[model samples]
Target chain A: MAVPPTTSRTAAELATQPACWRRAADAVPATEGLPRPGERVAVTGCGTSWFMAQAYAALREAAGEGETDAFAASEFPTARRYDRVVAITRSGTTTEVLDLLAALRGTAPLLALTADPATPVRDAADALAVLDWADEESVVQTRFATTALALLRAALPGGREAVLRAADEAATAVAEPLPAALLSASQWSFLGRGWAYGVAQEAALKMREAAGAWTEAYPSMEYRHGPVAIAGAGRVTWAFGPVPGGLEEAVTAAGGTFVHAPSDPLAELVRAQRVAVAVAEARGLDPDRPRGLTRSVVLGV
Target chain B: MAVPPTTSRTAAELATQPACWRRAADAVPATEGLPRPGERVAVTGCGTSWFMAQAYAALREAAGEGETDAFAASEFPTARRYDRVVAITRSGTTTEVLDLLAALRGTAPLLALTADPATPVRDAADALAVLDWADEESVVQTRFATTALALLRAALPGGREAVLRAADEAATAVAEPLPAALLSASQWSFLGRGWAYGVAQEAALKMREAAGAWTEAYPSMEYRHGPVAIAGAGRVTWAFGPVPGGLEEAVTAAGGTFVHAPSDPLAELVRAQRVAVAVAEARGLDPDRPRGLTRSVVLGV
Candidate 1:
């Protein structure tokens, strides 16, 4: 397959991920309303933001900071009590996140982690951690979500040292040539484990939102349980982190291509973002303004 | 799509769900080591059993039971501590579940919920809850999972009354004719929220395992986030619980058929099981013996 032209805003936004990661990681100490150590926390967001929240929750839990849960903004559990609720919205205007923050205002210490603190979430949340530098104009989010996750990752046990290393790796990921097969596969399955599972889910979302592709995501080990049944010719199974011992063999036996990048999972995510844009360009679609979507899902707008 | 013959072992197993429900619900009172009221619990399983754990966790939490978490057996966190760990595995010998149980044997109260208590789980878990009658010969599980969940549900706040009601609904579900479109669709998406979200995930797994179909699952509201981009003619989006008001319209606008059944979510799950078999038969496959699958995924078997 020819290298498709990547001229869209999404392409440019995605390419800046490395710089965004570094900046976000540096801003972590200054970010207000962040979940404190030992607090029981629940994070909520929509679309790409939700996937990022999942990554942050897993990272926090794995770091042994506290019990952290992630939910799609609309599906936030009202019955469960948490010490703090963090809402992630790139535009800071998604109705579900705003409504949830509004509803939980008095019940919990509501914190808004968003690209724009000046938006409606200002009144909805008790406090704000603004990342306006990572905000995007593209309907398909690329840098903002990862930047937010990078910031959150810096707050974990490994802190700035780990995120800085990831940013350095991402610098290479952004400039590298993608696997040609990824551009032509008819279907894609992205798999990971722990925090990487959320990255895998975000990778699949980028394929669907930017390229209108058939894509699915799962915890790497869970793929063989049933989903491997769909892995055949013209399909690709991409693993974000360490490839499970026999997964490559399983996918190969099923006549599917398997991809595993040794890059940091966040860095692998950057490469996947590039593939989304290239595939979109090849399909004659605009990754900047995806069909049947808007910059922010402001319902009834 | 002419009514595909349903003579497989999975078909017979699924048909007995209502009876299984009644027996499991009644047996709940006699079951050993069930999570007590206000106890923090974690449910772990693999494949179909894992999805059931998710449903049970959500249901328990919604009933205002103490915090309940679900994890795939392989993904169970070693860092987290719970009052009780519930392992759901029909085979009673899955390596990951057994490993988890063995690891937690003394740390927490270990409860094994399985088809046959005589298996390795008897030694691995501190307590055993047997439902051997619901054991299945088919690789594609239909009855064992629901029956196990029914047992768990009986311990929650509405208990037996609600479960027996759902069993009655399942009685109708097993006998109803599946939608013709479901049999012919080239792709499928199952959508649900909370506990039902897990059921939807299982529904999608059923499609892929039984028919080698292109299928996906998501939180109903999250569907529009990105997966909706895959919806188009020859695809079906089925909802287990309430269809989010505009979801049907959105799926319709994307040129896909939408299915929403008013039956209890468990009952709706039974109907999905039947559709899996029907679609498998239509594609010259057998649901009882899905490709690349075994009755028990005993590693290195």
Candidate 2:
């Protein structure tokens, strides 16, 4: 039997993130469907998109924009009122997203950010921000999720400059090699603080989705409570943004490799994506088509 | 050199769950600080407590009691207004809980559930529910967290009957021995839908804390997306509450051990707690004192 293609589409998609993010950042003004400064907002999605919603919610709230909440689409609180509700879906056809949008139609203004503008989400949403260029061929999503978030970040105060800088860093992150020791670690734990906690969760998800790695994620401060027990000589503890005070020492004392890079968390996530692909390749697995996964989930209710 | 006591306090405390739950159910009437029906609520905690908050939040919303949200104490959206905010901490002195309570003092009504009534949280919260009898000697929490949730559950409509039935089932769960293959599994994945997702997260945390095991948790339907790639011959996939359609078949097809007990999720959680202790005992690790963990976290700001 012949081996399949060596170059995964996930790798190709991941490599294009820096460029996609740059375009997303530049496209923010035209993407006017996002929540405004003082609007109470709820963001919803599924899987990786849900994780990105969490990151945006934390970032939006921390930036003093307004009260922002993120929820998994299936678990969204329908009774709650928000000034605006934003749904993020790479594929506009996800059942949960469509159902939620239909349920929320006349209640509040509904906005959706999707890679496909030609789907039912466009009709469901009152307004739409489409990033068709960021769509992926891989079952494992990489660029679309981050690109959507980049667009959201750009719309915030002081976010545009930061995102532009991070886009450059992401290019470097994709080109540079992942730490060999981390790639070979027996287990991986990702940690983040504030908005970065969402980044950490997404990074861990990327590793599991793209590489089938044994990975976990938690808030940096919560690591010492119990999750740190899993840290050992062959494990990796990667912090997405600023390491909480004394966390590096604790990870080192637990005999685990502590990794922190002075770059935007979004850029750090790009690095983690690269590592996931590299590790998957090393294990003779294709990152593009992860085992038993699809580009979009359309469940029959 | 002498090895300390082999019997774990966590094991002993876990065994007391059924009784503690009964007491909690009976005590719910006196627990005046719980959120009223139709009130928007936010629950906050750290570590094990946070997972319980997630479960309670899901249950509360699912019951149509109100829109309830749960957050790790540090991540609570202070800018958001809720009819009430509930903080759960086994030890009342956790810095994040104290800080959050202090921040929310004049904003709205604050309630706290803690095992230790004497701590500063007593003053920080506007109202308090103390369960001193449920306190634990073990650094790894078991009964105290579940017992607190039991009290919350009992306060909800029809929750008393459910709790009573679950208590009876919990007694059976604690007595039944966990599967030998599951106890020896190399990796574990826990899945739950809705409120059970929080139980799944807590179960995974218990395994990581008590046994230093590699564990992961996800919403049951979302498990097939990518995380199931980690499932294999030596891995375990345990589901709390009803197994989602096709999930059992998927897990079996992946060559992973599939575990689902037809019992209350809270009762299932008790079983998971037992599994954590059993795995710890097999590994010759002390569940009472997980490596580098304390009963409570008090960080200096």
Highest TM-score against the true fold, candidate: 1
**Poorest lDDT segment (10 consecutive residues) of candidate 2 chain B:** B1-10
**lDDT of each candidate versus the true structure:** 0.87, 0.88
Runs in model 2 lying further than 4 Å from the true structure: A1-6, B1-6
Q: Which CAPRI category fits model 1? A: medium
B1-301 per-residue lDDT for model 2 (tens digits): 1122347788888889999999999998788778999999999999999999999999999899998889888777787889999999989999988989999998879999999899999999999999988999899998999998999988888999999999999999987767777777889899998889999999999999998888999988778766887888989999998887778877888789999989999999988888888888778888887987888888866
Per-residue error for A218 in candidate 1, Å, reads 1.2
Which is the leading candidate under lDDT?
2
lDDT (tens digit, per residue) of candidate 1 on A74-139: 888777889999888888788888888877889889888788877898888888878888888888
Chain B structural similarity as TM-score, candidate 1 = 0.97
* Maximum-DockQ candidate: 1
Error (Å) of candidate 2 at residue B77 is 2.0
